[model samples]
Target chain A: MDRATTETKLINGYQHEFPLVPRPFQRIGESLGMDEDEVLALLRDLQDRGALARIGAVVSPRTIGTSTLAAMTVPPDRLEDVAALVSAFPEVNHNYEREHDINLWFVVAAPSENDVATVLHNIERRTGLEVIGLPMLDSYHIDLGFRLPCG
Target chain B: MNRIAPSPAIDDLDRRIVKATQSGLPLVPRPYHALAETLGVTPEQIMDRMRRLLAKGIIRRIGAVPNHYRLGYTANGMSVWDVDDAAVAETGAAMGQLDFVSHCYHRPRQLPIWPYNLFAMVHGRSREEVEAKVKKIAALLGDREDGHDILYSTRILKKTGLRLVD
Candidate 1:
């Protein structure tokens, strides 16, 4: 199979529900009509090409720390500095500037709610922008895995 | 601040397993053995703990994470909706069921400037594609959705998490 075909297979078939078996590669290869070696090679190549992010457990947030979605609206001139400052925080993961007046959005995870409060407060104090902490009230959908459309 | 429920069951060894597998597991014949050796535990012990982790819902799935940007679904949209608080779960679940929405969450609806309570991540080949998918979510939400906005990522600074595990 070509690289494109392999890529599609790996993305769609394995993105979610990776076999929990010890010999997962062998099982995946068997399903794909390839050997365990071929499966491993394909996966490694995909990683090298930056198509596959990782083959690992997607840990649920809040297991070890508390996290909340936060946003800050900055003046156009201060966007860069504010974004940089927010991104600098180790707790702020998935930082992005989206198309809206309330532009910057990110998730901050810390060991406790107190730490989260401190982080948000620090960001507010540092950036001079009110950090709106919108913690999750409920989870309608938890898993973030999306399948690549099959050819 | 939302009070986080303590998960005291996750002990030191569990932390080690999460640290080991967060990046990924091995791709060899005896992947569990490799992890066990690294963590100074028996293969069976690792396997048993991993199984418990899966059962306990600590691990979403043992899987491959794909980069949608590289996969040609270039347009990524963070679609947020202000739905009636009481009906959020039903509406959010419906939106989550949509194939294009990678994640759907019932976040708080901050007053004044921020009013969106439901967040769904929609992705497509182009901006238009993502917008179309968002519309489908809106339609599914119907009258329950008060207002909605799609925030296409201007810049993605970071997308992975390590703080919680480490």
Candidate 2:
């Protein structure tokens, strides 16, 4: 396989089928007909280029901790200041500005429910915006990684 | 209210493995061995725990996280809908099964201001493609769907994966 083919395989194919073994890279290399050294180097390069976000497990929020999707409407003028303040919280991992009346949206993940409450409370007080929790009541599909089209 | 049943517990070694690899496993020939040395465990021990973790659903999947933007999925439309609360489960399940809907979740609706309780994240090469997908969702939802809106992300202020600590 060529360089582009290998990258596509690494992105689309391996996103859901990483070998769990003592030397997982060796397994990946064996399958790709590339040596361990070559596979490791290629992965390192991809990471450096920001083409790959992370090669890790996607833990379930309910099993690991509590999390809630919160949104707020910050004044257009204060959007920058309020976003920066909200992003400063460790719990607020994803803070995005979407097109809506309640523009600012983020997710708060914590080890416990109390911790989540504390973060939301602090964000409310600091930003002076009514933060609404949109916790997931039921999740049917949530595969975060998307498959890249490879020809 | 959804009552979450307690899941099977993971022991100390499994927690250690999860913590180590949550950020990412080192891109190396013997990544498990490298992690073993740091955690004062054998390579086999680390591998064993990882195997169990994957099987037990603690680790959803071990895989590559393809940067969607880099892969040409530049548009991410989070389509939200106000559905009949009584029949939301059936409608949400139907929407979730759609091919283009990457993620579908039934969330609590904020009254008056925000009446959307069903959220489906649709990704595509263009905003038009995402809008078309949302239309499909609305069509599938039929009369049960009260109102729907697509909130395409204008800016990514901050994006980070779930981690134990910053």
Candidate 3:
């Protein structure tokens, strides 16, 4: 396979069911007919380009820690500033400006619920905007990962 | 909010492993071996623990998390729906079966201000495509879909994965 084809396979094939062996990359390379070093280099390139987040386990939500989907209605003029403040908290991950009255959306994850509450309270106090906490009541989807269209 | 039953099998070592690799595994030939060194465990032990975690569903999957935007999935919409409380479970489960719906969840509504309870993330190459998919969801809900709105993320101020706090 050529470079682009190889890259596509590396992504589409290994999104799930990645080998758990000690030399997993080696196994992957063997399957792709490339050496271990080549596979590692390709993965590094993908990471550098932000194409791949990581090659690791996607932990289930609220399994190791508690988290909630929080949103805030920041005035249009203060959107950027408020977003920066919200994103500053280490607990605030995956923050985005959605198109809605409650525009600033983010996820606050912490080892404990108390820690999560502290972050939310601090954000509310600093921004002077009410944070709407929409915690997940239940999850209906068990399957994760998108099925990429093959090139 | 629904509370998940804490797995009795997870221990401090598992937490340590999660903290180490929640972002990602090392991009090396022997990734697990490198992780074992970092966590002060043998490669076999690390691999064993990971296997068990996967079995227990603590770890959803161990592989590449592709950047959706980079993959040409730019039109991402958070489709929110106000379904009847009695039928949300059934509606959400069916919605999740749609190939276009990446994530479907039942979240509490904030009343008067926000009335949506079901959230489904729909991705497409264009907004039209996403809207069409949302239409399918609306049809799926039928009368159960009291009301709905799709929130398209305008800017990604922060894009880090969930990290475990110390």
The total of clashing pairs for model 2 equals 0
Highest DockQ, which number? 3
Q: Which 10 residues in a row give candidate 1 chain B its minimum summed lDDT?
A: B1-10
Which 10 successive residues of model 3 chain A have the least lDDT summed? A142-151
TM-score of predicted chain B versus true chain B for each candidate: 0.89, 0.90, 0.94
Q: lDDT of all predictions, in order shown?
A: 0.80, 0.83, 0.87
Clashing pairs in 3: none
lDDT of 2 by residue, A1-151 (tens): 8999998887777888788777778888888898888888888888888888888887766666778899999889999999999999988889999988899999998877788889999999987789998888888775746777678
Model 2, B52-160: lDDT tens digits are 7777666677889767776678898999999998998888878877878878889988888889999999999999899888888877878998899999888888887
Q: Candidate 3, which segments miss by more than 4 Å at Cα? A: B1-3, B6-9
User: Which candidate number would show the highest TM-score if scored against the true structure?
Assistant: 3
Give lDDT tens digits, candidate 1, residues B1-166.
Answer: 1222455478889878887888777767778889989989998888788788877777767788877777777788889888888887788778877777777888876788788888888888999998888888877777898898888887787787544623
Q: Is candidate 1 or candidate 2 better by TM-score?
A: 2
Cα deviation in Å at residue B106, candidate 1? 1.0
lDDT of 3 by residue, A41-109 (tens): 999998899788788888888888889999998999999899999888889889999999889999999
Better of 2 and 3 by TM-score: 3
Instruction: Give per-model TM-scores.
Output: 0.92, 0.94, 0.96
Tens digits of per-residue lDDT, candidate 3, B44-91, equal 988889889888878888888888888788888999999999998888
Predicted complex 3: CAPRI docking category? medium
